[model samples]
Target: MLALGIEGSANKIGVGIVRLDGSILANPRHTYITPPGQGFLPRETAIHHQQHILPIVQAALKEAGVTPDQIDCLCYTRGPGMGAPLQAGAVVVRILSLLWKKPIVAVNHCVAHIEMGRVVTGAVDPVVLYVSGGNTQVIAYSEGKYRIFGETIDIAVGNCLDRFARVLKISNDPSPGYNIEQIAKKGNKFIELPYVVKGMDVSFSGILSFIEAVAVQQLETNEFTDADLCFSLQETVFAMLVEITERAMAHCDKKDVLVVGGVGCNIRLQDMMRIMCSERGGNLYATDDRYCVDNGAMIAYTGLLAFANGVTTPLEEATFTQRFRTDDVHAVWREKKSLPLKENGVVNPGIN
Candidate 1:
């Protein structure tokens, strides 16, 4: 079966067409570059989504050489995203589903990230570390469900990065995170920062405030370079994530790791994660831009899996949920008692 997926979770509008076998026929993204001082104001972000949603979807359909009638299912992000953007995408999906008489599936945005990583890496049972604009958590499949082993107790990782970038007057031109990464690369010194990890939950708010104070002090005394501060900040935060992930792997007895979500695209973080995984005699997996960042392909791929398991939401039942959790969804993979021995690697059942 063929499915068309629409995603407008935050500042990006993505559209994709995918086959049931997990091949992406077409994938396209429209990014909204927020102006300086905008700072995620809901009204401004909503306006951005209104302007680009339809065009991106149309472009994806044209590129895929398919029409609404040709698509067997229509899928869209149900929630765990910005409210206005979710509404915009849902309105379009509702209309398309009605017009084409196709079944519509509502998918959780976080689970889509997890499934996308699995699809790209073909990892049987990997410990998942999801870090994005709105979330950060460690997950694993167990007892017929994806369980959350640990997560952030306060602000998200991406949000913290963006806020710090704004404070530094870094350009949000291409991407705020990218600009932060560039500034961080030029950093040469290590500045002490707050590290808050309560039990299995992490917090970044205090760290953000501390960084701002340091920046203020440097400005007053003309004492430090922004690059050094940026480098120190990234190192401290990324190390926290690596520490938690390592702990989760040991607790869960997982030998494989998959990193997903927008922040997963960060090269520095990926490098740190790879080192941690290697030390544990395991491997780390990451999705390319196609799946790492928010996109329609992951949403469609996840929706297809949900649909196959007899899951469907009615038009009236459709509603946006901004705080959906990964553990809320049922696991599609089932652990088998007997492991199959192969020349390549250990294989698990229920995943193609």
Candidate 2:
């Protein structure tokens, strides 16, 4: 069986085709980039997706060497994203579903990332560190859900990075985070930034505020270079992420940690996580940008898993939301495990 998936939750729009055996036949995507010192708006981003979705879908099918008749199902990101962009993908999937007389599956954006990480890295039951432009969450499967162990109390780590890049007037062509990662390599100074980790949850708004309020002026004064700011921000936020992920792993008694999401492609973040995992005698599982960044292939593979397990979205219920929580999905595809013992002040009723 083959499935076609569309993803336009944020600035990126992707179309992918996947076989039932977890093989990605085609995965093509385009990102809606803004000028330096600017960020993408939801309305404009949605328009970009609307303009490119059809062509991207066509390109995916052609590259996959498949016909519309061969596709058994349709899938799209259903939530936890910009409403307008989510609607752009959802409407296209609905149209395709009706036109092709195929089934539809509404996949959670975050779970798709985790499932993609699992399939790509062969990680089994690993704690997930999901970091993206809009979300920062530490999660793991428990009972019938991908339980959220921790998350951002305010702005996400990626958003903080992107906004700082805007202040620095860095290019957003590939990604703000990626550009920051590149320039950070040249940094020699480690400007101490606010490090906030409240229990398992992290707060980046204060850090962002500090840098925006102080670091920008310091950059003009030549007290620190832009590279130094980037380096300091990455180190501060990634350390918080590593701390929470390790804490979640200890809480769940899991030996493996998987990083998934757009920001998960950061080399420094991966290095820090690897070090943390190694110190705990565990493993760090991550993928390159092709899989780590949001893509339709992840959605297709995840929706395929759900479809195989007797799940499908009805036309009337084919909807998207901006506030869909990760724990709300009833991940019926995985087997339920017994609860774990409380650790570090966290009570685990199941294996999260």
Candidate 3:
């Protein structure tokens, strides 16, 4: 059994192939880089996906050393993203599903990230900290569902960073957040910023507003460097994130922490998480840019799991939405197990 997946929920367009055993054969991706002080538009991103979808698909197939006829199923991210981009990818997915006579599986974007992190990093049922441009949540599995333990109330972490990068007029070459991470390394001072963590959830809009105002003042007075602002933003925001994650871990009684999503690729964030986990006598598991960000391999692997468990999307029922909650999907693929957050970390069945 083979799966071909498409991921174009945001600025990046990715295609990948994976086998039934959770091994990736090929994954190719291209991101749309907007100029400084600008953000990605849905229509433009959709057009970008439409233009490169075929070439990237061909490239992925060739890299995987497989032909189109060898593919048994087609998968695409179904929701929780810009509608235009999802429709663009869906058009391709539907065409391929019809032309190749393969069943299509619509995977939840957030669930795919969790499944991918678990597969690649070998984190067996860890508390997942999913931080992406569109979402920020600390998730855990309980009662056959991935429940949101903590999340952002306003803007996502990555979106905050991206919008802040625009205020700083930084390059969006690879990504605004990535560039901010690099610049933060050069900063030594940490200016105090608003830290808001209500219960288990976080809010980044106030922090963003604070930084934007500081940037305006600094631009006129040259009082604070961009590096300092970047450093301050990362430290404050990541601290809030770590705080919430630790709360979730303590509440769930789980030691292992798995960080997924695009914002998970930040080295500083990983370091902070590692320190926090070590304090709790636990470990932090993360991935590189490949699986951490939106990619086709995650979709392929996740979709394969769903398909094998008798899940499929008919053409008429394959419509995408802008808000697909992770807990909405019934996770019938995983076994019921007891994983106390703080104990010995041994998973036992029949304890749910």
Per-residue C-alpha lDDT of model 3 across residues 95-125, encoded as one tens digit per residue:
9988899999999999999988876766787
Order of all candidates by lDDT, from best down to worst? Answer: 3, 2, 1
Superposed on all Cα atoms, the candidates' RMSDs to the truth, in angstroms, are 4.5, 6.7, 5.4
Steric clashes per prediction = 2, 0, 4
Q: What TM-score do all the candidates reach, one by one?
A: 0.93, 0.94, 0.94
What 10-residue stretch in candidate 1 is worst by lDDT?
A: 343-352
Better of 2 and 3 by lDDT: 3
> Which stretches of candidate 3 lie above 4 Å from their native place?
336-352
- Please report, in order, the local distance difference test score of every candidate based on alpha carbons: 0.81, 0.88, 0.89
* Candidate 1 per-residue C-alpha lDDT over 1-352 given as tens digits, one digit per residue, 9 for 90 to 100: 7788888889888988877667787779888887753466656777888888888888988988888889878899987888888888888888887888898888889988888777667776898999998899988888878899999988999889989888888877767777788889988889999998776678999999999999989999877899988898899999999988888999999877899998888889988999888888998888556678899988887787777667777987766777777778775534322123121132312111
Query: For model 3, what is the C-alpha lDDT against the true structure?
Result: 0.89
